[model samples]
Target: MSCQEPEFVTAEDVGGFDDLWSSYGFYNEGCFEKGAPLVLNDQQLFSDFAFMDDMHFDSISSAISVAAETDQPASNSELLQLDEKSTPPLPSKTSELLSKYQFKFNARSGEKPNESIERGGSKLSTEDFMRIAASFFIQLSTHKDCNPFMLNNQFGLSFSGLSSAEIMNVELAILLFSAAEKVSQQRFDHGTNLIKECYKLCSKTGNSVQRVVYYFADALQERIHGGKGTVVKAQEVMKALLSNHPVHLATFRSLPLEQIMQFTSVQTILDNLGSAKKIHLIDLSIKHGLQWTILMQALSNSSSVDYVKISAVGTSEEEITSTGKRLTSFAEILKLPFVFKPVIVSDIKELKEDMFKIEETETIALYSSMDMNTMIIKPDRLENVMKVIRNLRPQIVTVVDVEAKHNSRSFINRFTEALFYFSAFFDCLENCMRGDERVRMIVEEDFFSPGISSIVAAEGSERVIRQVGIDVWRLFFARYGLVEAELNQWSVYQASLLVKHFACGESYSFEVNGKALLVGWKGTPLHFISAWKFQ
Candidate 1:
């Protein structure tokens, strides 16, 4: 096919790749100027879908409103505009309620109320103080083997001081954590009891916290019954795949996580490729070939890109073929010289270098997102895969995976890590999809629930959700003679800008550790994206 002339358009005119960022005012003449501090339009910082409607935020606001009415009536404006620097004492009722829950209020000199609450110090607005107390309750339950009944008593100490929503948060946290603790101890009966109580306290259609807790409770119940509770027939799996595929795609469009990784990977590949005319991408998990659409668009805009080929690797031949066809169609639309090659393998470990059919002229880049971690369950298979990758001599290998340490041998340790990790993730989803509960639940149930089940319910090799931190990944890559490649500042800045455009963006942060970019939520690392080149 003859390629069309490259079209030059402004960032605002570009869709697909640039739509999310540019619409939020991330693109301008001096937006990406080197050494310039990344600044976002304050007005565009919070989207309509942002987390201002968070259940905890609302509950806290309600509780504070009640406190204000009793102590000294304060207007809604006064409540919101409270001085962050001042350490205003909480109402006597709120203080007693916190004290009963074993949460102390120690306001530090000149510290923000939120920061103080995070550090176990407080003189927070009644809202922030209650939110912190709920978090403390979860932490205390998870980290310590406290009696659930006692915790429940503490929660019941002064419901008059709390709104109905606040009471539900307390009840759900205690029940969910208590149930998780029992499951970890192998006390299946006890776990079942607490999970039942959790079910009664929360609903799948309820608030964000309720929905997340409900799912976790379901996973705990499955754990008690041993491994999914029943065998999943192939027909059932296929049926689920068919039903959930649309929701999955919608999630990709709605959430920034997947796009952030893909954008970074594509940028890394383009940076390394320079003016190479022949490009080959070996996708470890091609799925729907969504990431490559961005690459193809960029390549179509570049005169240097003469030929493009993708060897999509996946387990299902049908799915891979479908992805190849879709990409081929997209490539034709761009009038780009493109070839879609499907490399089907029964298992990722079965991958052979010859399967890729690499040509000497082709500049190759390998992209793996949440795929290699599955192979870690069998070290030999993973090492063999790495060996094949090393021998292929790809110009750059991009990796994006969960930044959690869930590969621990101890069940309790792994459970604790997974609980906190998924909690943050679900909380993030709640913020990102505040008004759109249906899509949010679909993503949670279809995409996230299985991973949670595998981590909590399965054992040994059956547990395929083995995610490790970047530190572990660095060590593993080093053993394979791969050196980390530094991600450019432009990519990091774009990622930061992308995150700040969402609700609760202040809670989301980006940190650079050596050669990797870590995406964190509320100070806890959730995922990392990095690039590596063979030494």
Candidate 2:
């Protein structure tokens, strides 16, 4: 199962629309093309898992069993040390991979998701919002037009080894900081003060690990956004800010929309008479069981569905446990029979890492809310995922991932585009204000210096700015014969929330430095496409 074999294909192999389409079996067969590739026919992807074409499932079983017996459980102190180990070292091999695929400076002329103009309206649609949200990751992974230096400038500064969580730590920090800057109040006083405070706290507790930096950065950004202008650095004041400061990382599981949609979708699908018996919910990063909670509720309400079991897999036990707790709490609150099993994996090699050996293939269904490319970027890994999908022969295989392009060609543009868009947001706002001093201070002092966008633009940085992750995911899905479906209701709810809370009644269409950009609240429905495998 070692991916020692290298089958590298140049961008030319799959570059042109016609060439790429033919190579991937997209144009020839209509089965692959569909709406956005949010989640496609679940059955097709997992159907291959049942076919054991020299797949070493037994090997995985043996390895898992051995690991279970030989592994010594780490205590609290050991666990804390383990957390420390999560911080990845700088100059990672993946850093180059990231740098190669920067965000693009694509025109923002594309239609907004579910936006409307009624003096007040939703900004996007459920389908479009999901696509956009997913696109965020796509832009991060594939686009190449962005500033690549940001990765090093921000989180890549230092690291022992970069784990997926560490990468996410940096990404999450950048995302939150950017979001805060866009929506924060008292930009000048609050933003700077928060950054300084976070810096001091990190110094006392730990160094500038990606997680710490991001956490502090995000918190400061959030506080500033919340209109908190307190100026007290953690160390200089010689006093603690609070009696007890809890780690306040915003969990995606907390997003009611995602939670509700996932649960509802699973239940709705399973309740159908033709639905399969066994159901699986696969998520790349299961922070908490918030998603499963909703699923559990939906399953409970279903008249046909009796017992729904969940196998929630993530990168680490900490993540699994966090998700498990959410599922457990949901059960406690609703009093349902929903059991969520947790499986922790460090890399894609572990997909079958501990899969139990069986004499014959099982009709197992698979679902994933993660980047499909993560499993396929490497040939062997990609084949492994495909092998698993083929073997399971699941009636359904719903995969949710960023569909952005990070291939050899579009890497630079992706990052550049992201930087441009972020810069544009601030620049547009600044222009609107006629160059306000406070705005300038916010941009120059707190916003510009260490922003993730800025980091991507830095020299030798692996970071790239991209439009968003969701759109790229949709395209990727189409390439793979996964049919897109209509946007889920939860997405619609999120779109509504953004419009209700964050919409500004200003419609201005202007080119930013020759790049067409659209800024305003127009009632244009966010375009969301879903794909299905008709075959």
- Give the best candidate by lDDT: 1
Off by over 4 Å in 2: 1-278, 353-365, 373-379, 402-412, 421-481, 486-534
**Per-residue lDDT of 56-106 in model 2, one digit per residue for the tens?**
223333323433454522121221121221111111123232222221111
**For every model shown, what is its TM-score relative to the native structure?**
0.69, 0.40
**Model 1 CA deviation exceeding 4 Å by range:** 1-164, 228-244, 500-507
All candidates' lDDT scores? 0.61, 0.34
Clashing pairs in 1: 106-122
Model 2: lDDT to the true structure:
0.34
Per-residue alpha-carbon lDDT of model 1 for 399-435, expressed as tens digits? 9887876665556545555666777777677767777
RMSD of each: 21.3, 20.7
